[model samples]
Target: MKTLYIVRHAKSSWKYSGIEDIDRPLKKRGIKDAHLMSKFLSKEIARPDVFISSSANRALHTGIIFCENLEYPLANLQINRQLYSFSDGYLVKTVYALDDAFNSAIIFSHDHGINTFVNKFGNTPIAHVSTCGIIGIKFQEKHWKNIKKGKTFMVEFPKNHK
Candidate 1:
Protein backbone atom coordinates (compact mmCIF):
# COMPACT_ATOMS: atom_id res chain seq x y z
CA MET A 1 0.00 0.00 0.00
CA LYS A 2 1.03 3.55 -0.69
CA THR A 3 0.02 6.65 1.24
CA LEU A 4 -0.24 10.05 -0.36
CA TYR A 5 -0.85 13.32 1.43
CA ILE A 6 -1.88 16.30 -0.61
CA VAL A 7 -1.35 19.69 0.97
CA ARG A 8 -2.41 23.02 -0.50
CA HIS A 9 -0.08 25.93 -0.16
CA ALA A 10 -0.92 28.22 2.74
CA LYS A 11 -2.40 31.71 2.39
CA SER A 12 -0.19 34.01 0.37
CA SER A 13 0.51 37.72 0.74
CA TRP A 14 -0.86 39.77 -2.14
CA LYS A 15 0.93 42.83 -0.78
CA TYR A 16 3.49 42.61 -3.54
CA SER A 17 1.43 42.98 -6.65
CA GLY A 18 4.51 43.18 -8.85
CA ILE A 19 5.82 39.76 -7.82
CA GLU A 20 5.09 36.58 -9.66
CA ASP A 21 2.57 34.14 -8.19
CA ILE A 22 5.32 31.57 -7.60
CA ASP A 23 7.40 34.06 -5.66
CA ARG A 24 4.74 35.20 -3.24
CA PRO A 25 5.46 34.44 0.40
CA LEU A 26 3.02 33.31 3.01
CA LYS A 27 0.93 35.77 4.99
CA LYS A 28 1.11 36.00 8.80
CA ARG A 29 -1.96 33.82 9.10
CA GLY A 30 -0.41 31.36 6.70
CA ILE A 31 2.68 31.03 8.85
CA LYS A 32 0.66 30.36 11.97
CA ASP A 33 -1.65 28.00 10.18
CA ALA A 34 1.27 26.03 8.74
CA HIS A 35 2.68 25.54 12.19
CA LEU A 36 -0.67 24.49 13.61
CA MET A 37 -1.40 22.02 10.84
CA SER A 38 2.13 20.65 10.94
CA LYS A 39 1.90 20.04 14.67
CA PHE A 40 -1.50 18.44 14.26
CA LEU A 41 -0.30 16.10 11.53
CA SER A 42 2.85 15.17 13.40
CA LYS A 43 0.67 13.87 16.18
CA GLU A 44 -2.14 12.37 14.13
CA ILE A 45 -0.73 11.20 10.79
CA ALA A 46 2.07 8.80 10.04
CA ARG A 47 5.40 10.40 9.21
CA PRO A 48 5.95 10.34 5.47
CA ASP A 49 9.04 8.67 4.03
CA VAL A 50 9.65 11.52 1.64
CA PHE A 51 8.40 15.08 1.22
CA ILE A 52 7.74 16.42 -2.28
CA SER A 53 6.76 20.03 -2.94
CA SER A 54 6.59 22.73 -5.57
CA SER A 55 9.64 24.90 -5.97
CA ALA A 56 7.34 27.89 -5.46
CA ASN A 57 8.13 29.92 -2.36
CA ARG A 58 4.84 29.42 -0.57
CA ALA A 59 4.60 25.69 -1.18
CA LEU A 60 8.22 25.08 -0.24
CA HIS A 61 7.82 27.08 2.94
CA THR A 62 4.72 25.15 3.91
CA GLY A 63 6.55 21.85 3.32
CA ILE A 64 9.48 23.05 5.40
CA ILE A 65 7.21 23.86 8.32
CA PHE A 66 5.67 20.41 8.17
CA CYS A 67 9.14 18.85 8.02
CA GLU A 68 10.14 20.73 11.16
CA ASN A 69 7.23 19.32 13.12
CA LEU A 70 7.61 15.85 11.69
CA GLU A 71 11.37 15.93 12.35
CA TYR A 72 12.10 15.22 8.69
CA PRO A 73 15.12 16.75 7.01
CA LEU A 74 14.29 19.79 4.92
CA ALA A 75 17.31 19.57 2.63
CA ASN A 76 16.22 16.14 1.45
CA LEU A 77 12.84 17.30 0.13
CA GLN A 78 12.19 16.64 -3.56
CA ILE A 79 11.49 19.95 -5.29
CA ASN A 80 9.47 19.45 -8.45
CA ARG A 81 8.68 22.39 -10.70
CA GLN A 82 5.67 20.61 -12.18
CA LEU A 83 3.89 20.90 -8.85
CA TYR A 84 3.58 24.64 -9.50
CA SER A 85 0.59 23.85 -11.61
CA PHE A 86 -3.14 24.42 -11.84
CA SER A 87 -3.78 21.25 -13.84
CA ASP A 88 -4.15 17.82 -12.30
CA GLY A 89 -2.13 16.09 -15.02
CA TYR A 90 1.18 17.41 -13.76
CA LEU A 91 0.29 16.42 -10.23
CA VAL A 92 -0.60 12.89 -11.26
CA LYS A 93 2.51 12.54 -13.38
CA THR A 94 4.70 13.65 -10.54
CA VAL A 95 3.18 11.08 -8.22
CA TYR A 96 3.47 8.35 -10.83
CA ALA A 97 7.15 9.13 -11.25
CA LEU A 98 7.84 8.89 -7.54
CA ASP A 99 10.67 6.60 -6.38
CA ASP A 100 9.35 3.18 -5.47
CA ALA A 101 11.73 3.11 -2.51
CA PHE A 102 9.42 5.45 -0.69
CA ASN A 103 6.06 4.01 0.23
CA SER A 104 4.67 7.30 1.53
CA ALA A 105 5.11 10.88 0.44
CA ILE A 106 3.67 14.30 1.22
CA ILE A 107 3.09 16.56 -1.78
CA PHE A 108 2.52 20.29 -1.49
CA SER A 109 0.90 22.10 -4.39
CA HIS A 110 -1.91 24.47 -5.43
CA ASP A 111 -5.55 24.31 -6.52
CA HIS A 112 -7.49 23.56 -8.70
CA GLY A 113 -4.84 20.85 -8.74
CA ILE A 114 -5.33 19.99 -5.09
CA ASN A 115 -9.12 20.27 -5.19
CA THR A 116 -9.29 18.33 -8.44
CA PHE A 117 -7.15 15.56 -6.98
CA VAL A 118 -8.98 15.11 -3.69
CA ASN A 119 -12.37 14.91 -5.38
CA LYS A 120 -11.23 12.49 -8.07
CA PHE A 121 -9.12 10.07 -6.02
CA GLY A 122 -10.84 10.35 -2.68
CA ASN A 123 -13.88 8.38 -1.61
CA THR A 124 -15.66 11.48 -0.27
CA PRO A 125 -16.60 14.64 -2.12
CA ILE A 126 -14.49 17.68 -1.35
CA ALA A 127 -15.74 21.07 -2.43
CA HIS A 128 -12.28 22.60 -2.18
CA VAL A 129 -8.94 22.29 -0.49
CA SER A 130 -8.46 25.53 1.43
CA THR A 131 -5.12 27.14 2.19
CA CYS A 132 -3.05 24.84 4.42
CA GLY A 133 -5.56 22.06 3.90
CA ILE A 134 -4.40 18.43 3.77
CA ILE A 135 -6.11 15.37 2.27
CA GLY A 136 -4.66 11.93 2.76
CA ILE A 137 -5.38 8.93 0.55
CA LYS A 138 -4.33 5.33 1.01
CA PHE A 139 -3.94 3.35 -2.17
CA GLN A 140 -4.33 -0.41 -2.27
CA GLU A 141 -1.73 -0.82 -4.99
CA LYS A 142 1.96 -1.17 -4.28
CA HIS A 143 3.12 0.58 -7.41
CA TRP A 144 2.24 4.24 -7.99
CA LYS A 145 1.35 3.83 -11.67
CA ASN A 146 -1.08 1.04 -10.89
CA ILE A 147 -3.05 3.24 -8.52
CA LYS A 148 -6.39 4.43 -9.78
CA LYS A 149 -8.37 5.46 -6.69
CA GLY A 150 -7.88 5.38 -2.97
CA LYS A 151 -9.76 5.49 0.29
CA THR A 152 -9.67 8.84 2.04
CA PHE A 153 -7.57 8.42 5.14
CA MET A 154 -7.78 11.88 6.66
CA VAL A 155 -8.53 15.53 5.96
CA GLU A 156 -7.34 18.57 7.90
CA PHE A 157 -7.64 22.31 7.39
CA PRO A 158 -6.54 25.46 9.15
CA LYS A 159 -10.15 26.34 9.87
CA ASN A 160 -10.53 23.14 11.84
CA HIS A 161 -8.26 24.57 14.50
CA LYS A 162 -10.07 27.86 14.75
Candidate 2:
Protein backbone atom coordinates (compact mmCIF):
# COMPACT_ATOMS: atom_id res chain seq x y z
CA MET A 1 0.00 0.00 0.00
CA LYS A 2 0.99 3.59 -0.57
CA THR A 3 0.17 6.51 1.67
CA LEU A 4 -0.06 10.14 0.71
CA TYR A 5 0.00 12.76 3.43
CA ILE A 6 -1.32 16.06 2.08
CA VAL A 7 -0.36 18.93 4.33
CA ARG A 8 -1.50 22.51 3.78
CA HIS A 9 1.10 25.15 4.56
CA ALA A 10 0.67 27.10 7.77
CA LYS A 11 -0.92 30.54 7.89
CA SER A 12 1.24 33.35 6.48
CA SER A 13 1.95 36.83 7.75
CA TRP A 14 0.72 39.92 5.94
CA LYS A 15 2.91 42.26 7.95
CA TYR A 16 5.31 42.60 5.06
CA SER A 17 3.31 44.31 2.32
CA GLY A 18 5.97 44.73 -0.33
CA ILE A 19 6.92 41.04 -0.35
CA GLU A 20 5.41 38.87 -3.03
CA ASP A 21 2.77 36.33 -2.03
CA ILE A 22 5.20 33.57 -2.88
CA ASP A 23 7.70 34.98 -0.43
CA ARG A 24 5.41 35.57 2.53
CA PRO A 25 6.58 33.89 5.72
CA LEU A 26 4.53 32.16 8.39
CA LYS A 27 2.92 34.01 11.26
CA LYS A 28 3.64 33.38 14.95
CA ARG A 29 0.44 31.43 15.32
CA GLY A 30 1.35 29.50 12.24
CA ILE A 31 4.67 28.51 13.77
CA LYS A 32 2.99 27.27 16.92
CA ASP A 33 0.42 25.37 14.95
CA ALA A 34 3.07 23.84 12.72
CA HIS A 35 4.89 22.57 15.78
CA LEU A 36 1.70 21.23 17.30
CA MET A 37 0.68 19.51 14.10
CA SER A 38 4.14 18.10 13.64
CA LYS A 39 4.13 16.60 17.12
CA PHE A 40 0.75 15.07 16.46
CA LEU A 41 1.85 13.63 13.13
CA SER A 42 5.09 12.29 14.52
CA LYS A 43 3.30 10.38 17.23
CA GLU A 44 0.43 9.14 15.08
CA ILE A 45 1.88 8.32 11.68
CA ALA A 46 4.97 6.61 10.40
CA ARG A 47 7.63 8.84 8.92
CA PRO A 48 7.27 9.46 5.22
CA ASP A 49 9.93 8.01 2.95
CA VAL A 50 9.73 11.01 0.67
CA PHE A 51 8.88 14.65 1.25
CA ILE A 52 7.83 16.93 -1.62
CA SER A 53 6.89 20.54 -1.20
CA SER A 54 6.25 23.80 -3.03
CA SER A 55 9.11 26.22 -3.35
CA ALA A 56 7.03 29.01 -1.86
CA ASN A 57 8.40 30.34 1.42
CA ARG A 58 5.50 29.40 3.65
CA ALA A 59 5.19 25.92 2.25
CA LEU A 60 8.91 25.27 2.41
CA HIS A 61 9.03 26.49 5.98
CA THR A 62 6.14 24.29 6.98
CA GLY A 63 7.83 21.34 5.34
CA ILE A 64 10.98 22.10 7.27
CA ILE A 65 9.11 22.10 10.55
CA PHE A 66 7.46 18.84 9.70
CA CYS A 67 10.77 17.31 8.79
CA GLU A 68 12.31 18.53 12.01
CA ASN A 69 9.56 17.00 14.11
CA LEU A 70 9.55 13.75 12.19
CA GLU A 71 13.33 13.50 12.21
CA TYR A 72 13.44 13.26 8.44
CA PRO A 73 16.72 14.31 6.94
CA LEU A 74 16.79 17.54 4.93
CA ALA A 75 18.42 15.81 1.99
CA ASN A 76 15.30 13.68 1.47
CA LEU A 77 13.10 16.67 0.60
CA GLN A 78 12.33 17.68 -2.96
CA ILE A 79 11.25 21.24 -3.59
CA ASN A 80 9.16 21.48 -6.74
CA ARG A 81 8.02 24.77 -8.24
CA GLN A 82 5.14 23.01 -9.97
CA LEU A 83 3.61 22.40 -6.57
CA TYR A 84 3.32 26.12 -5.88
CA SER A 85 -0.12 26.43 -7.50
CA PHE A 86 -0.88 23.01 -8.83
CA SER A 87 -4.34 22.01 -9.97
CA ASP A 88 -5.93 18.70 -9.01
CA GLY A 89 -4.84 17.13 -12.29
CA TYR A 90 -1.35 18.45 -11.86
CA LEU A 91 -1.17 17.26 -8.27
CA VAL A 92 -2.31 13.80 -9.23
CA LYS A 93 0.13 13.68 -12.08
CA THR A 94 2.90 14.68 -9.75
CA VAL A 95 1.96 11.96 -7.30
CA TYR A 96 1.77 9.41 -10.07
CA ALA A 97 5.25 10.28 -11.19
CA LEU A 98 6.83 9.68 -7.79
CA ASP A 99 9.61 7.13 -7.40
CA ASP A 100 8.32 3.68 -6.59
CA ALA A 101 10.96 3.28 -3.88
CA PHE A 102 8.95 5.46 -1.60
CA ASN A 103 6.10 3.73 0.17
CA SER A 104 4.86 6.84 1.91
CA ALA A 105 5.18 10.48 0.92
CA ILE A 106 4.24 13.92 2.12
CA ILE A 107 3.19 16.87 -0.04
CA PHE A 108 3.37 20.23 1.64
CA SER A 109 1.54 22.86 -0.37
CA HIS A 110 -1.25 25.44 -0.48
CA ASP A 111 -4.96 24.99 -0.38
CA HIS A 112 -7.61 24.76 -3.13
CA GLY A 113 -5.39 22.33 -5.00
CA ILE A 114 -4.69 20.25 -1.90
CA ASN A 115 -8.35 20.44 -0.98
CA THR A 116 -9.45 19.47 -4.48
CA PHE A 117 -6.92 16.66 -4.60
CA VAL A 118 -8.02 15.21 -1.26
CA ASN A 119 -11.73 15.61 -2.02
CA LYS A 120 -11.25 14.02 -5.42
CA PHE A 121 -9.32 11.05 -4.12
CA GLY A 122 -10.59 10.67 -0.55
CA ASN A 123 -14.19 11.93 -0.33
CA THR A 124 -13.39 14.71 2.14
CA PRO A 125 -16.16 17.34 2.24
CA ILE A 126 -14.25 20.24 3.72
CA ALA A 127 -14.90 23.83 2.66
CA HIS A 128 -11.45 25.13 3.58
CA VAL A 129 -8.52 23.20 4.87
CA SER A 130 -7.20 24.90 7.99
CA THR A 131 -3.62 26.11 8.11
CA CYS A 132 -1.20 23.30 9.02
CA GLY A 133 -3.93 20.78 8.37
CA ILE A 134 -3.03 17.31 7.21
CA ILE A 135 -5.12 14.85 5.20
CA GLY A 136 -3.84 11.32 5.06
CA ILE A 137 -4.95 9.05 2.24
CA LYS A 138 -4.14 5.37 1.88
CA PHE A 139 -4.04 3.75 -1.51
CA GLN A 140 -4.41 0.04 -2.08
CA GLU A 141 -1.85 -0.04 -4.84
CA LYS A 142 1.79 -0.74 -4.26
CA HIS A 143 3.04 1.79 -6.80
CA TRP A 144 2.08 5.43 -7.23
CA LYS A 145 1.40 4.88 -10.91
CA ASN A 146 -1.39 2.49 -9.94
CA ILE A 147 -3.16 5.00 -7.76
CA LYS A 148 -6.52 6.33 -8.92
CA LYS A 149 -9.21 8.73 -7.85
CA GLY A 150 -11.76 7.47 -5.32
CA LYS A 151 -9.42 4.70 -4.23
CA THR A 152 -8.60 6.11 -0.83
CA PHE A 153 -9.09 3.96 2.25
CA MET A 154 -9.09 6.73 4.80
CA VAL A 155 -8.96 10.49 5.30
CA GLU A 156 -7.78 12.21 8.47
CA PHE A 157 -7.78 15.95 8.85
CA PRO A 158 -6.42 17.98 11.78
CA LYS A 159 -9.73 19.72 12.46
CA ASN A 160 -11.46 16.39 12.64
CA HIS A 161 -9.19 15.42 15.52
CA LYS A 162 -9.57 18.75 17.26
Candidate 3:
Protein backbone atom coordinates (compact mmCIF):
# COMPACT_ATOMS: atom_id res chain seq x y z
CA MET A 1 0.00 0.00 0.00
CA LYS A 2 1.06 3.54 -0.70
CA THR A 3 0.14 6.41 1.56
CA LEU A 4 0.22 10.04 0.54
CA TYR A 5 0.13 12.92 2.97
CA ILE A 6 -0.66 16.23 1.34
CA VAL A 7 -0.18 19.51 3.16
CA ARG A 8 -1.18 22.90 1.80
CA HIS A 9 1.34 25.58 2.59
CA ALA A 10 0.62 27.83 5.55
CA LYS A 11 -0.84 31.32 5.17
CA SER A 12 1.51 33.66 3.33
CA SER A 13 2.36 37.26 3.93
CA TRP A 14 0.72 39.75 1.59
CA LYS A 15 2.26 42.68 3.41
CA TYR A 16 5.57 42.35 1.58
CA SER A 17 5.53 44.69 -1.40
CA GLY A 18 7.57 44.15 -4.57
CA ILE A 19 8.31 40.50 -3.76
CA GLU A 20 7.46 37.72 -6.16
CA ASP A 21 4.75 35.25 -5.24
CA ILE A 22 7.26 32.43 -4.92
CA ASP A 23 9.30 34.48 -2.47
CA ARG A 24 6.45 35.36 -0.15
CA PRO A 25 7.09 34.22 3.42
CA LEU A 26 4.68 32.90 6.00
CA LYS A 27 2.86 35.26 8.32
CA LYS A 28 2.93 34.91 12.12
CA ARG A 29 -0.30 32.96 12.14
CA GLY A 30 1.06 30.72 9.46
CA ILE A 31 4.07 29.85 11.58
CA LYS A 32 1.87 29.16 14.58
CA ASP A 33 -0.47 27.02 12.53
CA ALA A 34 2.41 25.10 11.03
CA HIS A 35 3.76 24.31 14.45
CA LEU A 36 0.37 23.30 15.74
CA MET A 37 -0.46 21.13 12.73
CA SER A 38 2.95 19.52 12.56
CA LYS A 39 2.92 18.60 16.21
CA PHE A 40 -0.58 17.22 15.87
CA LEU A 41 0.37 15.10 12.89
CA SER A 42 3.51 13.84 14.57
CA LYS A 43 1.36 12.24 17.21
CA GLU A 44 -1.28 11.02 14.79
CA ILE A 45 1.01 9.20 12.35
CA ALA A 46 4.42 7.74 11.88
CA ARG A 47 7.16 9.58 10.01
CA PRO A 48 6.61 9.29 6.29
CA ASP A 49 9.23 7.65 4.10
CA VAL A 50 9.92 10.88 2.27
CA PHE A 51 9.12 14.55 2.53
CA ILE A 52 8.94 16.85 -0.48
CA SER A 53 8.16 20.54 -0.64
CA SER A 54 7.72 23.33 -3.14
CA SER A 55 10.66 25.64 -3.51
CA ALA A 56 8.41 28.56 -2.64
CA ASN A 57 9.37 30.16 0.64
CA ARG A 58 6.07 29.57 2.40
CA ALA A 59 5.81 25.95 1.35
CA LEU A 60 9.41 25.17 2.21
CA HIS A 61 9.06 26.78 5.57
CA THR A 62 5.95 24.76 6.30
CA GLY A 63 7.79 21.60 5.30
CA ILE A 64 10.63 22.50 7.59
CA ILE A 65 8.31 22.93 10.52
CA PHE A 66 6.75 19.54 9.81
CA CYS A 67 10.13 17.91 9.47
CA GLU A 68 11.26 19.32 12.78
CA ASN A 69 8.14 18.18 14.56
CA LEU A 70 8.35 14.75 12.95
CA GLU A 71 12.02 14.41 13.90
CA TYR A 72 13.04 13.95 10.29
CA PRO A 73 16.41 15.31 9.31
CA LEU A 74 16.29 18.75 7.72
CA ALA A 75 19.01 17.85 5.24
CA ASN A 76 16.86 15.04 3.88
CA LEU A 77 13.92 17.17 2.82
CA GLN A 78 13.56 17.41 -0.94
CA ILE A 79 12.78 20.77 -2.47
CA ASN A 80 11.33 20.75 -5.98
CA ARG A 81 10.71 23.83 -8.03
CA GLN A 82 8.05 21.93 -9.92
CA LEU A 83 5.95 21.77 -6.76
CA TYR A 84 5.63 25.57 -6.76
CA SER A 85 3.02 25.25 -9.48
CA PHE A 86 -0.62 25.99 -8.70
CA SER A 87 -2.04 23.39 -11.11
CA ASP A 88 -2.76 19.71 -10.56
CA GLY A 89 -0.72 18.59 -13.57
CA TYR A 90 2.59 18.96 -11.79
CA LEU A 91 1.14 17.38 -8.66
CA VAL A 92 0.00 14.35 -10.65
CA LYS A 93 3.30 14.02 -12.43
CA THR A 94 5.23 14.29 -9.20
CA VAL A 95 3.24 11.51 -7.55
CA TYR A 96 3.50 9.28 -10.59
CA ALA A 97 7.23 9.77 -10.66
CA LEU A 98 7.75 8.87 -7.03
CA ASP A 99 10.16 6.02 -6.46
CA ASP A 100 8.48 2.73 -5.76
CA ALA A 101 10.80 1.96 -2.90
CA PHE A 102 9.13 4.49 -0.65
CA ASN A 103 5.78 3.46 0.77
CA SER A 104 4.73 6.95 1.84
CA ALA A 105 5.47 10.56 0.97
CA ILE A 106 4.40 13.86 2.43
CA ILE A 107 4.14 16.76 0.02
CA PHE A 108 3.94 20.43 0.85
CA SER A 109 2.38 22.46 -1.94
CA HIS A 110 -0.29 24.98 -2.91
CA ASP A 111 -3.87 24.87 -4.19
CA HIS A 112 -6.11 24.46 -6.22
CA GLY A 113 -3.64 21.72 -7.06
CA ILE A 114 -4.03 20.19 -3.63
CA ASN A 115 -7.81 20.47 -3.81
CA THR A 116 -7.97 19.02 -7.29
CA PHE A 117 -5.53 16.26 -6.48
CA VAL A 118 -7.26 15.04 -3.30
CA ASN A 119 -10.66 15.02 -4.95
CA LYS A 120 -9.33 13.13 -7.97
CA PHE A 121 -7.18 10.61 -6.12
CA GLY A 122 -8.87 10.39 -2.76
CA ASN A 123 -12.25 8.83 -2.05
CA THR A 124 -13.33 11.84 -0.01
CA PRO A 125 -14.57 15.00 -1.66
CA ILE A 126 -12.84 18.07 -0.38
CA ALA A 127 -14.09 21.42 -1.65
CA HIS A 128 -11.07 23.39 -0.59
CA VAL A 129 -7.73 22.81 1.10
CA SER A 130 -7.12 25.71 3.46
CA THR A 131 -3.79 27.03 4.61
CA CYS A 132 -2.04 24.53 6.92
CA GLY A 133 -4.54 21.85 6.05
CA ILE A 134 -3.44 18.23 5.68
CA ILE A 135 -5.08 15.16 4.21
CA GLY A 136 -3.83 11.59 4.18
CA ILE A 137 -4.89 9.13 1.50
CA LYS A 138 -3.99 5.48 1.20
CA PHE A 139 -3.75 3.61 -2.10
CA GLN A 140 -3.92 -0.13 -2.64
CA GLU A 141 -1.59 -0.06 -5.62
CA LYS A 142 1.89 -1.50 -5.32
CA HIS A 143 3.48 1.08 -7.57
CA TRP A 144 3.16 4.83 -7.53
CA LYS A 145 2.21 4.97 -11.20
CA ASN A 146 -0.62 2.51 -10.65
CA ILE A 147 -2.30 4.44 -7.85
CA LYS A 148 -5.90 5.47 -8.34
CA LYS A 149 -8.73 6.65 -6.12
CA GLY A 150 -8.07 5.43 -2.61
CA LYS A 151 -9.20 5.96 0.98
CA THR A 152 -9.01 9.23 2.81
CA PHE A 153 -7.64 8.31 6.19
CA MET A 154 -7.17 11.70 7.76
CA VAL A 155 -8.05 15.34 7.29
CA GLU A 156 -6.94 18.15 9.57
CA PHE A 157 -7.02 21.92 9.35
CA PRO A 158 -6.03 24.73 11.69
CA LYS A 159 -9.56 25.92 12.36
CA ASN A 160 -10.80 22.46 13.30
CA HIS A 161 -8.01 21.99 15.77
CA LYS A 162 -8.29 25.47 17.24
TM-score of each: 0.97, 0.91, 0.99
lDDT of 1 at 3: 93
Task: Tell me the tens digit of each residue's lDDT in model 1 across 1-162.
Answer: 999999999998999988998999999999999999999999987799999999999999999999999999988988999899998989999989888888999999998988888888889899988999999999998898888889997888899888
Quote the RMSD, in angstroms, for model 1: 0.8
Let me know the TM-score candidate 2 reaches against the reference structure: 0.91
Residue pair clashes in candidate 2: none
Sum up the clashes in candidate 1.
0
Alpha-carbon RMSD, candidate 3: 0.6
**Which ten contiguous residues of candidate 2 have the minimum total lDDT?**
149-158
**lDDT assessment of candidate 2:** 0.84
User: In candidate 3, what are the lDDT values of residues 1-162, reduced to their tens digit?
Assistant: 999999999999999999999999999999999999999999999999999999999999999999999999999999999999989989999999999999999999998999999999999899999999999999999999999899999989999998
The candidates, ranked best first by TM-score, are 3, 1, 2
Alpha-carbon deviation at 75 in model 3, angstroms: 0.5
Candidate with better TM-score, 1 vs 2: 1
Name the best candidate (by lDDT): 3
Return the TM-score for candidate 3, rounded to 2 decimals. Answer: 0.99
TM-score top scorer: 3
lDDT of 2 by residue, 15-44 (tens): 998989999999997888888888888998
Error of 1 at 37 (Å): 0.2
Question: Each candidate: what lDDT?
Answer: 0.92, 0.84, 0.96
